[model samples]
Target chain A: MADTSSPPALHFTGHRHLVERLVLSTLTGRPIRVTKIRSSSVTDPGLAPYEVSFLRLLEAVTNGSQIEFSYTGTALAYRPGLITGSAAGHGASIDGVLRHEIPASCTRGVSYFLLPLCLLAPFSKSPVNVLFTGPGVITSATPTGDVSVDTVRTAILPIYEQFGIMNKLEIRTTQRSNPGPGGKGGTGEVQLIFGHQVRLPKTVHLLNPGRVKSIRGVAYATGVSGANNARMIEAARGVLNPFVPDTRIFSENTAAGFVPAPERNNAAAKRKMGVGFGLSLVAETSTGVRFSADVAVPVEGGVPPEDIGRKCAFQLLEAVEKGGCVDVVAAFTALTLMAMGSEDVGRIQIGRDVLGSEDIVQLARDFKTFGLSGWGLRDAGEGSEDIIVSIVGRGVGNVGRKVA
Target chain B: MPSLAPLGKRKRPTEAPKSAPATKPAPGTKAAEPESDGDSDLQAIFKRAFEAKFAPLPFAPAADEGNHESAEEEDEDEDEWTGFDSESESESESVPAPVVVVHSTPSRALEIDKSELKAFLSSKPPTAAKPTPFPSSGPKPTPAEDEDSAANLKNDVALQRLLSESHLLSADRTSGALDPTGKNRHKALDLRLQALGAKGSLFKQEKMPMAHRKGIVRKGAERETKRRKEAKEAGIVLEVAQKAKGKSVGRRERAVDAPAVGRFRGGTLVLNSRDVASIEGPKFKSKGKGKRRR
Candidate 1:
């Protein structure tokens, strides 16, 4: 190897792409420096709490890492250490839960942090586990709805599943959290666990997302009129039923998880918090493609069930229209798995039209960060919109992972 | 710094600038040795670009020996190779033409074209107009010979084409003028006329190598369908039955182009019905008046 003694370093301006940078650095075992994070801002400017928490999680997972930051906190440097399963490097039994759970930072969706875990998990000796804290860790990208557990369950988990590690991985929400402006960050708790001793990840070949068969969803209401959940479901179904006659929308009254919203103490402090309620729906196709859309009650006045329902319905339809085995969000993750697969070439076929987005543009840039083999990525050229990406992996077996 | 500019500027919008080998995922094994320094010229250029953007830091240790060539190449070319060589994987596929799918729905069996026949019927003299219910064949499957032959071909001579008898309308002919409210048969006929008039272009078909184009997929077909399609003798010709007895004027055509429109109701069939004929009754002109040599 060129120089494991001192890794190559990269630099950047802000934390906008911080998560990607750090995750990439950790994976490549390269060092990097970042500068001018929120330097332009007069407010308590620096890396956001989410960015800091992500770094902390990375540090927790790896051993002998070196991290330095400027006193102003605007500039920082990181040298990644070896990524091992057991906190103790050599030999130890690995259990994610028994060790400790990295607290998922707020404002940032845990998927942002969890993604690196999924990428790194299979390679580690021990499975990775984390419990999210901060405000709104267990909520939807939508305003108020079911804990995002299902949304990601269908979207993110599939990445790990494609790697031959189905039972070894678990990402489930223990409690639902509602994101609110009044310091109640939904406080929903979710547990993510990666199993140790996963089977070697193999290349994946997913193609042809067939037509959508039906829509399954959850309409959740918490700390609000329980009827609001029903109303949201009714409204959403009304819009969706016209297009998809077989929609199964169930209502889950989620408010029981938290104490009554009266700021918990003085009954006089009770101001009507527009009940936290929303809908989460996933449209499944005959070809294993899943499209998810969420609509939650906003922080301010509640959205009429009609609007939320219609918007969510249309959003699902739009994602289906994009025509891929994976949606735009899931495309990058699935591509990453293929990027990290077996030693031989791997290919995946996706609807051609979806590749024209900016995500693919960013992905191209990101794909370059990983050193590829044989001039790495290639698209098997044909005259259709469906494409097959081929790559020969620099196989990432769980080489140096140690047990507790 | 990597140029903020897009990777492929000279490409059409549909061909996304994708497949750049960002960071190759770490394989389970060590990177292969660069036996010969004769790597791709494009690779050398981009290596330099990456080095300038992320030069090795001062305190950083030496570049990994395995990739020392890449690191060294970067430092050597830092002063040259300013032009951005996008890491786009395929030169031919980076910028694909916009996807223009033409659903060539084949022509359906005939139905009574009332509106087409109506305008002619109403315009004729009462004596000439025969207000008839469309021929009984109007609602039935066209009794055209080719369809009859197709029916004969099936072991049981099956009828009513299951596949969309409507051939896909090529993108160009789809926009051709056709009455929106008119019958599907008329639209089909209009499309046929457009195709016939625009024949040579469609005849010498060129099968595009989808993989050659950025977004074209070769999933249903094996990989490299484009290579086979491009090098093949003929392009894909959709299997469809010819227009049902299109050449033989059927009863439907007979009804629309009836003798009444051209001939006067009470006049002899031999009488000149041209607009130039003495409709002196209309303009009240002398029948023998010399043609005005304006």
Candidate 2:
């Protein structure tokens, strides 16, 4: 498969949108070469630890994937491979689950790796089963703008149901953690099982985002008092009950996770990490669309649970006030599936502010670079600020699933 | 207890003059009798009884006029009252004046449903729609609907019987009615038994002689062949003839109490090659020689 006749690699620069580029390259079976990744920075002028860890995860799930880095780690050349997900003898353990570990020095949340991996799971040849356990798995929201794992399960996963891939999808978190001191690492465990594989995602035309019918939430306190969860639930209800009376928040309190903090002489010393509380709110509309908000205490730990809960509630209100069928957090996943669907026009309504965000606009440019057609946009014509985006699918879906 | 009596009398005369001049004489007369322990004792007893049934009263000069009349009538009874009762009455009156009622409400403890907790907090994502609980017993059906349902059930059974019995009527259609007393009625009854899963026809002769059975089978085959030949000569298409099924060659199961090997007869057991082979069980096949090996 590594012959000279392979297509020329697409070129990209800068470290921004690196995950999106790699995901597109894998789905399209094309090779990518990214240069000048954090090249201007003096102390860290290359791909970060989390990025390298993500590349390592990509290699574990796929077969024949090649990754090459320069001396300074600025330039990278990645050749695509077949997504043989969790198949026996392909870096998967005896139970047919690929275990990916994040380093203790990594700062990003676990959702950073989970979101893109989910996009590739449905197109893989076999079912994707991955268990994420390590010291760096932060289950809560981080200061770097990543959502908590609860939002990923309650809000983002339900979006795949509309695309005809709903069976056997589950996300189990045996342990919960917030970011450790200095927002570096946490000890957490999470497992993702995506058993539904389809050749093409069904085209969707979702325009009407109905009124919010109910609201559900989770208030998690790790290594902290259970009263913090009660306080957060009360504060969040104070803001959300008047708008939607069917609000329920479940409380979860677990002991603080401990990691090995051994010194030169003491080999058995362990310190507690991820001691904080957070709230995750998901507002589901009558049409089954979901909008989510997350707020967690910083690692320095001065914020009260009331502030975190109120902030999360107001953030959920803002997400709903944006007025679209898809939330800004889930827009990328929805749009990517539409672009990879069968050869037909799939239309979805998105808020103007959501579409104007940096991540979604860059996603459009990346799709164009991959040789896909441009999107067609028009006003939703409901006296609102929503824009209906119509995308044409690539018709080349699930290259690994073609044999089946 | 007696120390506050003078103070009570002094304030009463001062407030009484403000309401009316008519009441001034009453309070002035009460003040003159301030040394009378009997009058103060009766007032203390009345105050305790009132406070027990209702709220404690503040200083009311108007009620003193009514109590003065009752005081004269109960003067004899007050003398018989014990000294311990008067002391306890004074103590009760002192506490109500300085008492404070603190209204403390307990915090509400929301009881989370166990089923709901299992549904939402489990590993799987929560289902989109909540399950609506079904009513244990539905409302009683109206009399009109009940009668209509019963009538429909009766018609359904009648229609089912007609569908199965209509073939019997078609065989003798010239009469245009049911033949209740003819051979066709017996045939219809046999068909009903077969429909109910009977093993075989009751009219079949199970113990006929072998020669008689062979002759009957030959006659039936000859009649079927004759009809097919005439139809072919007349150039009329006929239905295909069905082949007779061969007898099964499998062994019959023996009774449980019988011997496992050859049959026992005349006080001696008879053994055959087939029976001996059954006792020895199956032999293994040799791949090289294409033969069986024990």
Candidate 3:
């Protein structure tokens, strides 16, 4: 067992940073990027330009160091100048024109100028490339004068692709009304344009190496206690069954310890401390197997061996031992009968100071169905230590044959 | 022996046993003389009684005539009867005196004499006991005998007048000498007079003049009129004043601008235009035709 007596001081050195990065990467499945850094003081050597003050404070605390800090420095601000400004202006104008036009159309007739303004609002004040395919008379009126449609398309296509918004932009034109005091009439020609922009912020992504920290097993005589081993194995199986039913359990003996069933039972003379057994239960999904084992004697106080190795061996043996069976009837029947008649198995206590007589009687009757009988005992020691009986059973095999 | 001699001698001169002392009244010579005098006295008493029964008329007539003749004669006679002068027999001669007949029927005379004696006993000299003088009159009636006598006389006269007037009036009505309408008019007049008298007495006792009473009635009427005028004015003025005052007070209160103590007066806090513009970003501009700049 690992020493878990006192919490050790956490190291916030390079190793600690590596561990943190590893944990974060494993949890999020992505490289953690640091966008900016802020520091409280210029004199602190550990303070980096890109390190946040809170992270610095945490590192200081973990390193068991004192830091006298004052106000934090201002964070670096990113502004993309005319691109952001134009984009914001375009969005506002588009939203405003849409909001104004939709309601005005519903309330009155579609104004000729409003629709044209709504169409052109996204392109206004920004140098946006546009394509045109119209009557010769209409195409000749371009502001740049004499630009072909293919040239315009080529110019704007790369920009749209770079922003990853090529599918969102549409170039079209329609005739609609604009309503205001200066509106000329109900119809006018206007162009519609749409686009997006990409922003590369000041940030960096980093990755760290990873490795397994620990591996554990399900077994008795492994310092997990026989009962705890059984409970853990049961809980695991219980969880697996919802996703995969038709699971079964088996056991074998091995020098390593008790190996799961259908595996070659290997034993060495010097290492044979005692007879050993294992139980393996496979989920119906065949995706995994859960197993538990008990070794009568153990050479070391740890889990015997990995069930994965035994499972591989069991798969090979399963071919040769086709329909070869072990009789778990006696073991199962004994377990069932013991579960029925063994008083200790299901014995329940009507706890002292329980109020209703009827509840006590019902509890007693319920225990009786398990063939358990109980009498009140004073100073019975700790309730969980009181084991009144033990059960034993022979193994069983597939094809309903005994193998003991 | 001595006894025989005395018996013969005494028989001669013992005055015949004193002759039984004229037991029959000397039998003749007018044993009836005293009886006659008694009869004369009885006659005289009868005559005096008859004269007394008739004397008051002549006495009063003579007094009236004597008054016509002279106060001196009457005074003289009064003085004689009054016994003021013991020596004045001439005064009695000048007047016809009361007759006094003397006769011998002593019983009847005795009765008269008894009456005379009673009179004489009763009649002391007026000088000896003078009558009380009349009480002097003052603002208030005197409680003396004269006042009593006068009151009695007045009461008698009033009773007589009341009886006589009531009888005359009733008789006049019954006789039909006056017409029925006249009688009724008189009756009404009388009743009115009675009512007026009653009213007059009531007014006098209360010490109020008619004009003063009239003044009081007029003053009460004026007071009622003034009260109605004041009430009407007050009703109109109160409503208008209250309304005007209320409006003025309301205007003043609104104009003062100082927050009232209990009313919710602090205006709500609203974000200024710059703050809102900064927070929400710039407002979207419209692309309508721009206003012509001046």
Candidate 4:
């Protein structure tokens, strides 16, 4: 038995103070509208007002805690989208005889020729700092030019992958004159624009250098005449899109109905062949959030009970990944028919008996309320009890099933 | 011994001068002799004067004869009062007794007159003074007085009984005794009364039965026992829960992916959207173009 001594009541008084402090700091940094604020009895009153509110929200959503809120105005929920980009720049300088003579030449050829020469030139004995500024700041500087873009897309990659989002990449370059007077006038700029987008088989890591190397030849240039600048930006944006996918997928699968008796059986045996089908449902609530659920039922004599169970389990797993609701009642009804014997016609056991009258009524109500238009179901084989059912909704839906 | 010498030559005759009685008498020797003579003469004079002053003078012959006649008449009066003179010799012997008798009769006569005066005063009226009885030579004992003594003795006995009862009661209260040896019923009764008085004050006019007091005490004991048991059970459960929670928290900590901001010792960089756009566009373009030109 669970030792249920009285747990101390949560005093929210302490959280009030903490919430105030947190809200003050957040407001000081940036103005934000407080759409809803709730204080839970379980929260410590010492918590800052903002922190307490945030924690209370977290508890309410995750722990099934009831929450009450006084909202001042409508709160805008943030819709997360894919974010993608690349860290790119160059760092080098020419000095002494080569630096002096390169700019002295009048022809563009000489200037262009000097580029490769600088690339091939021996390392300078004198060290000079080369600062590269771009879309992402260089958090740290090393002699070797390496940069990192630490943003939300990169931070939430794992969460995105769990939802089955994919990432793709692209790169591009541009040309411009060096700002310094040393150049003849025109200079070539190799702008490596990294682009990414969601793709299938979400397990793939977009930030992997190997993936970047594979996509090197694909310039990913969209149609734009003489618009080198626009091309570069598009290429970078494209690379970043695949880095974070904004799409969400939800799906579920289940089996329904009973099997028929042997051919030689009497009228009672013929009655055993019940109507049941497999069902699968998938729905996407948001670009990156999906909900799915599934249920499967066995057909007597047509399919093995183990097979039916495995199919049902697989349907549920698929639904879970989809992150949506399922029509549990219909799925259970179908499963019960499949489990019925030919001799047991007109008998259904739900919650310890053949589908109880109340259970049937509840099943119908559940179906009517949560059933989506695009739900799917499929039977395993002709005269076989094997069936799959799937349904999807905004989020995880009602989960109910008869043990029998 | 009187060796006189000049002051200057005193030293020369110093031994001789000192021999002037090697000890000349003390300075007041001559004056002391005269004072001693005067003291002896004064003492002799005082003795003579004291003798002359205390000597009694001789009586006159006539006064002696008068006193003799008064003595003879007193003898005659005595002889007359004696009515019987037995033998002459017996009479002579009884003569002295008659003189005593004669003198006593006069005194008797004076006492009779005083008695008569007292009688006359006493007989005068109803307002006569009652003779006051003389104080008894020793303390007069009364039955009431004896009763008082008896009461005192009883009080001592009562006091001793009370003291013993108190000692026993205190011991009983501390030792939790309902009844001790039954030798002294009175002591027991007293103890019981004291206990009742103490218990009575705690309640209103309605006396609390002994059984009810026991019931209340027993109930309190039962409640204490139950509370202790509950506390022990709660403590064990809390300990287990705490340990389980700690393990779970440790696992969660291991699973957490530390934010990149954690490495930002100086401060995390918060680049504005404009800054990011500039760097990604013109900055990249500038670097690329410069490379191409070179």
Candidate 5:
């Protein structure tokens, strides 16, 4: 929409961190170009189904976006437009909800889309209302390492509250499902309503990785015996009770979801999908810092419920032992909000391991390419291995917001 | 007290002669060996008895020993007393070992409140309005305050019930009791449910003959007018009656594909005079007092 000179598109390579880069482009109203997206793989190359579905979702939410792919589907270019959320007469339906259907070929969990959508919601012109449904909507953790929807609600969303974006936020799971056979797809439904928007996120200094005071969790069994939930809770509590006596893990059980799978002769045929059990645990510190762990049964399904529970408990302890204000699961969100804050610098003390990961390293490189300032890091204190990262905002806040 | 009294009395008679070896050591020298042991034993008995009735002695009997010899002598005397003292003292010491067994509670007690669990597990993220109230922080309400709250709640509920069900309570109807009987009770419950935000009364008949429904409406209106007339005669003010709603004169819902201004009859479009007049231009009136222009 700009007739004047706009900045040239930032160049990148490979498909890694595609969602994060696209989100940054949308927020800053910049154009991005990338080459060699899984180009090395001969059998299957270019963007995956879930990634293309995410791009479609972005087009639905924003006003005047453009996306193009090369002939081989490797190279790509995207020019982002104003984020007009779920405004009526757009792709939104009568109820003001944008219905997005995931194809049955998708393997990644629904959280793969949800986490990035939340980062963009607070800067949109209006509220973001999306209803995710279809056979590919896996509500449980997938073997591909995507977390479950429950963890997103229990763990990641609370971090936004620290940034002063904490009103009218909700995630409603109408149907719960685990990954289907071979980790392919599941029939599930989820709705996300994010009504809070701001001119700019508030600056924050989360320096203290406080002591863990309580643990809360959810154990769910879909289309399986609810005794699986009991077994999982028993095993998880057996481990966590010694450390924090104030632990509570609630149990949820539901019937398996059904999707139409019509054969040649039978047109009304339907089959059950997403039948499994899983557990998600969240540990909240005294200062409201949250560390989360999630584990689900694989589609081949030989592992016992007790094993899943014990594995999740140990996972939570490992996250807590990393010793940071934000764990690896939530570090991206915290760091992004800090970099997108008002002009002042926001500081956060993160675990050395979490900061040294590939995702954060790539983000640092992408920031430099986007003409944003580099991060300033120093040791946290006397005995901590944590590095306190200080990020200065670009002072280019929400372009969609009209009010002060 | 009586049991210990008899035991002490029995021990005193045997101990009086045992002290004869310490002061007159010549004649009782042969007996002095056991008698010296018995004399120290008697000192221990008196120490225990004095400490039991009053405060303990500041100094121990072993403190009087000047060097290692007297300490050895005290140890030798104690070795002989365990074999020589009565059996009841040893029995009381052995009885306390079994009582020290440690008993632990269950590691996790799933004592969750139903409402709290439902709220936490609901679709929305649990609002951090209140953190999980640990069972350890359970506040103990005082009995006096509990009683006061209970009485106040009971009075409030009674007052609300009376206000909502006042019409059901009449002198001829069960002599002005708080609760009505049979059909009136059901009606009272329906009224309460409607007040609680139910869309309509549960007893409202959805299907009925048109004539019967109209008759009931007329009878209700007649009854209301009679009550208003009586109230007016007695010089008592009454609420104004609400006027009945008029029939709607708005546009009817039509199908999306239907023609706007014509009816399709037998594959032919027919428009009325008003529709045709609207399609044509409005005719301008000629001014009588001015020149008429083309």
Candidate 6:
């Protein structure tokens, strides 16, 4: 690992880089300064409540973190002070955990703030349990690129599992609240419980995603006629039933982990009801690689449900055909994990033109910022297959994770 | 966590895994290298890949327990930072103390039942049961009706069976059809089987599948369907629960399903889930082909 003793201060404009910057800064013990948030954009300028709430949430996790925000709300200086985990001699027992149940500000998805926690949880001295209250489903009002259970399940979980730290992962949607964009309901609550301590990931070479083994999905309707769920399943299945060998769809009545379907009295509930429907599909390969795609029912109509189903099915097909251990969306996330893993060979197959994408290449640059090395982006040399981003974690791992 | 081993061991190109491009070997890692041979990872990957592809896949990938310890006496003293201060720094004041717990949420630890945990680790929703991890009998027969055609089956065991009948001619080739390239003599036999039709069956659509015809989702889809049925029964169950609790007003909720409109609480917890419908792969390829070809 490179020395972080004198790493320069990080500067950013707008709130876009907030999560990534915090995640990296926390690990490296560096300070970050974010300035001019939405100064250029006149429409809804300055920091939103969600951003402030995000900072407050961060404060709740750490013991003594310094956060200085400008009066105009344009400039903010954050110096990570203390990480709250476990006490000494408590390093080996997984029982030592710092639990914080936060009432997440409803302006955005909990996934936005959850990323930093997920990344930092492994390295924290103790396991972390954060219960967030926010819109459980992604909506137009939510910030763009906010992750959900979909990405958390397919992207983050797999990366942690490779580190032999999977036994404790739990992200159950305990309660469904107000659907986002516009709706009136109780705020949804999701409890994300994970980690005892970081199990430094071993060197991995995940080049091939292998063949698609099974494709399954769920179609649910909320505040609308339950029949909509049936239509979605039928339409999605119509598109998926030709190529996939094993396909299944769950409806409002059958989707797993749900408390149970509620009666839809559109006339009675009226304005209180938020009408929406969606489908979630996962294409799992023989090699343990999973590609997931989903579609939410649109507020506007005439866009057939068949198209939604077809889009999801094809997205998964592309993922499998791309032949990577990680899906395209998950490629960067996996690279981030590799950069932060143990000091052994780690490799992942991102797309052939992965380096063409600026964000993907930024991963290498970000690793450099953390003062970690023995990593690079290189051609897998299999005649234009997905490029493999390789790394050796500084072996920076925490102790005292008890396996309950 | 990596133990501080002696650093500055010269690079062994022959030992590095082929799959890994170990660029810019850092100063702090070689000392803590646990595997005796670096090439072992490359070999293990190839072996695992071969087994995963060639043999049946239900056989899980093996875990390397780091047994390859080879004692090597260091010849040269390493760089100044090679002796590494990881141990001391790890125990620094920045260490997080396990306090400040908010008792609002459920404080359940990872005491998951083994069977239940396995299913969760499988990454399926809670409704999905644990997949049977084994191959029965001699050669595992590839089941009829790949996932594509199986969606329509939807728990109609009879319909599912009909969709997957052996459509091709028997190995004996009594029907005088030429064998195809695939290992299965009846690979496309179902089509011909349907064409030939069952004895005394009048119409093409009227013909029923052989009672024993198989499907790949022998257990899974059945269980999924059964689960779906049970979930449907949950409505009645929900009513029962409501009657038992005698609460007629509040709306019910389901996990990852459609949003259940609970009685409008003043405080709304708005967590957003991303819609997975967006992808234009073909358009992306065509648009980027010329720009990315080089």
What candidate 4 gets wrong by more than 4 Å, as runs, is A1-41, A44-76, A79-373, A378-404, B1-294
Candidate 2 lDDT over B1-294, as tens digits, reads 011121222233433545433322223223223434666556655766676797654443344554464345345444453333452344233322322222222223456677877777787776665563646687789999999999999998767766888877877656766443376678777877988999987778898999999999999899989999999999999988777778886888778867778888888888899999888888765666755444
Residue by residue across B1-294, what tens digits does model 6's lDDT show? 123333324222223433222342222222223435556555555655675677423221222332122112122332233543564244232432223321122222223245643554343333322264555666643565455357556556444444554343344355453444354434444444565684532223443565423453366568766766787887533232222355577644556644443322456533333222222222334566486764
The 10-residue segment with the lowest total lDDT in model 3 chain B:
B1-10
Q: For candidate 3, what is the TM-score? A: 0.11
Span of 10 residues, lowest total lDDT, candidate 5 chain A: A1-10
Error of 4 at A190 (Å): 31
Candidate numbers sorted by TM-score from highest down: 2, 5, 6, 1, 4, 3
In model 2, residue pairs whose N, Cα or C atoms come closer than 3 Å (at least 3 residues apart or on different chains), thus clashing, are none
Model 5 Cα lDDT, one tens digit per residue, B1-294: 001112222222222444322321122111222334666567667766786797644333431222233335435554333332443343223221112222222465679779978877877776544665556757788899999999999999989998878877763365556767788888888988888888998878989999999999999999999999999999999987788888887988888877888877888889999889888868777756557756
Put down candidate 1 lDDT per residue, A1-404, tens digits, no spaces. 22467756776777666766676666566688999999998986787765676777777777667778788779989987766644443332243442323232345445556666667777665566655644445454533222255566655565455556666566655555555554234455666666644435777666556677667676666666667766666666666666676576666665524433445567645332224666778887665567777766565655676566667777777777766667666676666666656687766665565666766655656657546343233353454455666656657655444232
Q: In order, what DockQ does each candidate have?
A: 0.00, 0.18, 0.00, 0.00, 0.26, 0.02
Residue-level lDDT of model 3, residues A233-306, one tens digit each, is 34333433333332222111112222112325544322211122222221111111111111121112233333
Ranking 4 against 6 by lDDT, winner: 6
Give the whole-model CA lDDT for all candidates, comma-separated.
Answer: 0.55, 0.83, 0.27, 0.27, 0.81, 0.53
The recovered share of true contacts, given per candidate in order, is 0.00, 0.39, 0.00, 0.00, 0.52, 0.02
Q: TM-score for the second chain in candidate 2?
A: 0.37
Candidate 5 clashing pairs?
A: none
Please provide, for model 1 over B180-263, each residue's C-alpha lDDT reduced to its tens digit, 9 standing for 90 to 100.
333445554555556459443333336766566434333524444554665564665544424445566655545654474345
**Candidates sorted by lDDT, best first:** 2, 5, 1, 6, 3, 4
iRMSD, all candidates: 31.0, 4.6, 89.7, 79.2, 2.9, 15.6
Off by over 4 Å in 5: A2-4, B1-106, B129-294
Kindly indicate the candidate among 2 and 5 with the higher lDDT. Answer: 2
Residue A86 lDDT (model 5) = 91
DockQ (C-alpha) of model 3? Answer: 0.00
Worst lDDT 10-window in candidate 6 chain B: B101-110
Candidate achieving higher DockQ, 2 or 5: 5
Give per-model TM-scores: 0.51, 0.66, 0.11, 0.12, 0.64, 0.52
Model 3 chain A: ten consecutive residues of lowest lDDT: A395-404
